[model samples]
Target: MVQKPTLAAVTHQPLARWIAYLNAVITFKTPQGMRLTNQDLTHQGHTVRATICHVGPEPADGTMLYLHGGAFMIGDLRMYRHLVARLGQAARQRAYFLHYDRAPEYPFPAALDQATTAYLALCTDPAAGPISLVGDSAGGNLVFALLHRICTRDLPRPAAVAAMSPVVDLRMRAKSLTTNRRTDHLVPTSWARRGCTAYMGSADPMNPEVSPVLGQFDGAPPCLIQADETEMLADDSRAMAAALQAQGVQVDLQMSKGLIHVWHLNVGRSPEADASVAEIGRFLRGVTSRETV
Candidate 1:
């Protein structure tokens, strides 16, 4: 079925536009929310940021080290507040947003290193137990890297990993890259390439650190990849799933229709967003519930 692109599909809400505009306007921000009050046990020296959004009733079972989407060039924790808050509600726990380094400044390993350090710190916190990782857009790329790095070092793997419209393959060779090129209103191929250039800084786009879809997920935990049918990166999930499944890894791949890019970013408004979050919530719940926890 051919889906028509709309403001909803593209996340063209006035709020989104304003946020994008603000991101473009400001290079650095204090982030409007409760600042990092303390991180002694969980994150010793790591700079782990958080925005408390209505603490749930259940015990703090686990933490979702969430990374935001901006093609790795622009965007911060605030841009994902709406979706991350709802994700916390979905998981019935707290979600910590990572204020990682951006592109054109600290490229490649810098951001990945910070995220890995933060993850290691979080794992140390018993309060932040049963940790899981998730991200959207370029953040998804980080999640892929986190999984691979953890596997390589023979460290503790997260319970599960989830990504939305992840640019897993920085080379952008996914079939959907060309298949849905004209339909994905929010992010065009040209814009994506521009951001990729800024983040990689002359590094090969296909480098596993840059494009995780081509990397290893064999020893990693359960993984899920979600993408919008109208987004050119839908094939990112397709390719990642095939690779993981080939290695006998548990993977849940969902190609949502009637949305652009990471529909889950729209959370409250887009039905597609709700569905995507719900799916991830279910995956997390299943993992934490069925297993030791």
Candidate 2:
């Protein structure tokens, strides 16, 4: 297998800086005819930054919240604009790409707090319509963490949820971390450990707020989880699916072969990535439709 130079770049340097450098050099073009609008979501004295993407006129169907993945240290609305726009177009709903605070600076519970606040703001808005959540990698961790907060606080639930190559386990105990080390070219275990440590700070690694695989999902909306079967985080998705199923939440676990982590970001360039995003869009549409019924 050809090694991923980008993944190898961060293995030995300051992760955040290297990722920022990578983000600067690598770019994805936003889909044409997509309307992009920036908004500040304020709730309970907290404000979260977000961008809304739509193909043409905003659809009245519903809304999708997309959280980008960069191991909690790097990633922003700019890096994921193209993918988010495509997803919104696919689901035929307005998509909001959240710009939550990152770690090594924001640390544990900061992103979670902001995400939950954003969700609450959306839920309270009658104009927001039915809401679903989609996140990748560390953002996926926040998806469940936010769900746990909603469940425990008895807040309104999202219409559906989707996680791509999510880092569900901060404790990093999954066997695939070792077994798939050779096959997974995108995420190195050491790099993942460093990212986790930066994000966790003094918090316990096993804290369910950080390691969402340990969180409660009893009342979570229907969830779609997609991950590459050979990626190091493969078991994270597997374990999360099992946990959600045990809690009686409807779950769809789609495992692909020989793909990089969060490959859905390659939509428009890779057929597999396009297919994966379409599937997620379909799942979100299906569940949100049922939610409205």
- Candidate 2's TM-score reads 0.93
Cα lDDT of candidate 1 equals 0.72
Q: How would you encode candidate 1's per-residue C-alpha lDDT over 38-101 as one tens digit per residue?
A: 2322344656444444333543547787877787766655566667767776876567777787
Tell me which residue pairs clash in candidate 2. Answer: none
Q: Which ten residues in a row have the lowest lDDT in candidate 1?
A: 1-10
- Model 2 lDDT per residue over 150-237, tens place: 8878888888999998998888889999999889877777767778888899999778888888888767889999999999999999
Per-model CA lDDT versus the true structure:
0.72, 0.83
Off by over 4 Å in 1: 1-60
- CA RMSD, predictions in order: 5.7, 2.2
Candidate 2 ranges with C-alpha deviation above 4 Å: 1-27
Kindly report which residue pairs in candidate 1 clash with one another.
none
